[model samples]
Target: MPLPYSEKVMEHFRQPRNVGRIEDADAKSIEGSPACGDMVAVYLKVDRESLRIDDIKFESYGCASNIATGSIITELAKGKTLEEAKHITWKQASEALGGLPPIKTHCSILAVDGLRAAIENYEERHGLIREHKPTTIEVIRKRLKRVMNPMVGLDLVRTKVVKDIEIADGVVRVAIDLPADHQFAANIREEISEKIQPLWDVQKIVVEFTE
Candidate 1:
């Protein structure tokens, strides 16, 4: 099938912007969608005084749409202030690509998320106020660990741990690794939500089953 991407998106995929690595990156983050088996790592150098992203690069492993998303996000973030970069939304990234298929929308969202995460890591290291919040997965993990019954045996019931967490637009997304045929998946999700309701405001929970 022909990809649902703009001419600009195809062009960027063919000739990606900022394709190489940054020699000295101020901030860097790696993200993967285990559900889709898409992984991307972004490296960035920001001008602290101006909060502007000076250089950006990416290494991606996924389909063409994933590549297009990373390329466009990097181009948009470079030379923009942290505040400005944070404002760059998935909608904008998708729009830049002409448009992505409904299912592929998450790929673009992941790119925007990866960029924001790198920036947040930069700010955290520099003692700047963090713009993103803790993801739902993080909260769930913490809660689970605290209340887990060691006597019940962690192995008896299928469990997924939070492998990666990101927050955007006041919503928390958690990447989890779980067994594909685990019969208790629904109950586990509910348990996680119930546990985290008091401590954090969770917007969404993304569960990724790894075979």
Candidate 2:
């Protein structure tokens, strides 16, 4: 209730536009994690001849920042060329919403990631173009970077609270080091868990917290 949110963010959340899916979406992608308690799905309808995004929609699962980011991302992407839309970074998305709170930065990342993922999914599924995909660890870091602390305005990994990440046989192990008075340990663990759940190779996730 006391979270810092820009007016643009509140406006979008209060009246999120393009909240559904496109039946014949040219590109569709789901990103983020339920364990982290934020997830986003993007759908794009492109013009066949021009390769411009004619329409776009999204499905968001999370808090106000999540829904607002998803809404703003779609609005920004619509009517742009696929390449242009794919290049829309999370920072731009956040800026379009008049800048998101530090804690909500990751929400913008998830929104932009969802859109780019949809584009990549479209290209791969259609045999249009092939690109270098992120390794599992890179993917994990990207997700973790968005799991920012509300109080600190930095991600757990960047703040060194999340010390290490390990993966073996589709199971992920996370190591967390927090000050004893840290108020968000449980929530942080849940966020990290949710972020990795969508990874194809990730079957299970275990979080360990330390002093």
Candidate 3:
């Protein structure tokens, strides 16, 4: 039997870089979930004067690809200015590791998202963030695309699991096409909340199922 991963992927999995948390990290963000078995927490130490990522680290809870992606992204982001690091996409991270299986591509998404989220946190805390426009259904739907369905490893939007979306009075309501008792239902619901809860204009999130 042969491994599906590239040599670079295997190398990073065996010896992932920056594999721990920073005690006083300037900014940190956790993405994915335990239920999905693919969570990653990214920590960043930025040079405020230069707005550069002085150091970066990650802790991952997932498979080989997940660990490998996390390692590669941290390596790629280190020493880059936040503006530059924010341009580190999942595809770029995957290519850096030779490439990942299509099924495992979501791992790279999680890794890149974790890094970008940490950068966003740093910017928000340092008042470097831009003023967000009013949140709308399109904004909510776009964010939902990042919420992967654990069953297929694809986002809710792409999998067509998201049936509908609505917002009123600062509350966002999402209707997903899954049985309320489906095994992955809880995971999906939690993923949706994580993705939508960060909207500046969203005061609350409501996820409901529609079989």
Candidate 4:
């Protein structure tokens, strides 16, 4: 890979901005694209009174372009009002990176999506915005727990132990620690896909065996 980005992108990747956690973040959001193996978690400290982003931090797992996108997004969001931050787009991130290659455009889009999701979570939790429905993750997790619990014979699987569950652009990706060659692995994958596909237009399901 001869670097799928311009010099600016490399610079940001090498010296990423806000590359850590916010100790007392008001809101945190994580998004991942299993197709591209990219994951980003964004934490924000919002000034509730002003409804502005007071501080921001990001931790990402992926390629250089993705890291650069995350770094640029955090810098762009800091000090901006929630409304302003919502308008931050992939074009702005790509421009900041001096432009990414056509193939890597989704990387920038992913970062933009993650930022928007974090802000949305913040607004919803603080009553800054009202919605008639809960988030898809909440709804799907509930359904999965209800429907799949009987099949798995477990009360609840630790969400943290899941390691990775990401939804983006109508696609959901889950990585679990099950044995690859286990007799029931295929059945489990099928069961999950069958359960969740009806709830969402799941594009992919990746099962990683930890043991």
Candidate 5:
């Protein structure tokens, strides 16, 4: 049987609306990692006078959950003022989809983070905010260097299994590779979540595995 998915997830995944690009977009932002298996790019046409997102489009390369999330986020942000759109959180995206499987929670984060990054860029260029933004994944290793696999007793970084990590929109996602039948998969996720949750903006942590 296929993995169980909520009706909303299937709806968005099967027929993702706003599935392309916005040309000469007033603001654009992209997040996720190609090497680790997902990337999301968002483009927006903003009404400068009203500071509202007039139009939005996205291109995504990832699993079904990621695609669904990209679709839902656009639907949520479209026509909303920039301030309102900027406040769109991962929780709202997942809630709209009736919640995701724990493993798929990261996809929602990817969706919202992409939106925030684009808006942040737009704001910076418009002189709404003035702070340097790192164009790459920021400090993944330093934060979770101590997260260990209970069975192997090897920290994630030292084990070299952390293919990619992304943290934003109050969510943390770490993708790793392990044996398909690894017994402690859930344990790994729980332990890592425990260690990182307190320190980061992480309201949720997704420990995804590639077998």
Candidate 6:
């Protein structure tokens, strides 16, 4: 069978742009994990006056799709203002690359996530982020959608693996429908914490397995 990837995907994978770290970056983020066999790191240098991304780069540890997505995402975010870059989506990244396989769609998601996280970090550092809003279960669930299940290369929320979510008094509890000893259980838990821990109002996080 022919390769499933498009020509754009192959080209980017072969010579991914911005494939290193920016040691004095204005902001940076690293997402994904070795357990998933995929990780992406993003760094940015923003023009504080214009709030534009003066420079952007990425380092990816994963498949061809992962590297390609990272390359395309940085190209899309560079020269854009923080507000504009925040709107860059995984679909846009995949489309820019001509498209990715259905099974590898999460690669785009991971790449876009790294970009957004870096932007958020910059905003937080420069006091551009808005004041804290009340945390809700719905918000928590929405964020959980970004936590992919390594076994399936799909998010836990989309796969219906997030059995329950509860929040009260600054504490958030999440119940995942996986065996406690499952190979990716710890990785999933860590991803869940990373997603929720950023909330200003979330003082604690508790993840439990419900197998």
Q: List the residue pairs that clash in candidate 3.
A: none
lDDT of each: 0.66, 0.79, 0.89, 0.71, 0.76, 0.90
In candidate 5, what are the lDDT values of residues 1-211, reduced to their tens digit? Answer: 6657788999999999899988899988766544335668999999889999999999999888889999999999999998999999888999998888887766567677788878877886687764534322455565455455444444567778788888667677888787646776766666566455544235777878887
lDDT of 1 by residue, 18-76 (tens): 77678689988765433344667789888878988988999787777778999999988
Best by lDDT: 6
Backbone-clash count (model 4): 0
lDDT of 3 at 23: 91
lDDT of 2 by residue, 1-211 (tens): 7549888899999999899989988889877665556789998888878888899999999889989999988888889988888788888888888887785666667788788878877776666675545337667777777675545655677787767888788888877787545677777777777667756567889887776
Clashes of each: 0, 4, 0, 0, 0, 0
Cα misplacement distance, residue 102 of candidate 2 (Å): 0.7
Predicted model with the maximum TM-score: 6
Better of 2 and 5 by TM-score: 2
lDDT of 3 by residue, 156-207 (tens): 8999988889899999999999999999888888878877776678899889
Alpha carbon deviation, residue 40, candidate 4 (Å): 0.2
Compared with the true structure, what per-residue lDDT tens digits does model 6 show for residues 57-112?
A: 99999999999999999999989999999999888898999989998877767888
lDDT of 2 at 199: 60
Q: Is candidate 3 or candidate 4 better by lDDT?
A: 3
Judged by whole-model lDDT over C-alpha atoms, candidate 2 comes out at 0.79
Model 4 spans with C-alpha error above 4 angstroms: 1-3, 33-36, 131-211
What is the alpha-carbon lDDT for the whole of candidate 4?
A: 0.71
What's the lDDT for candidate 3? 0.89
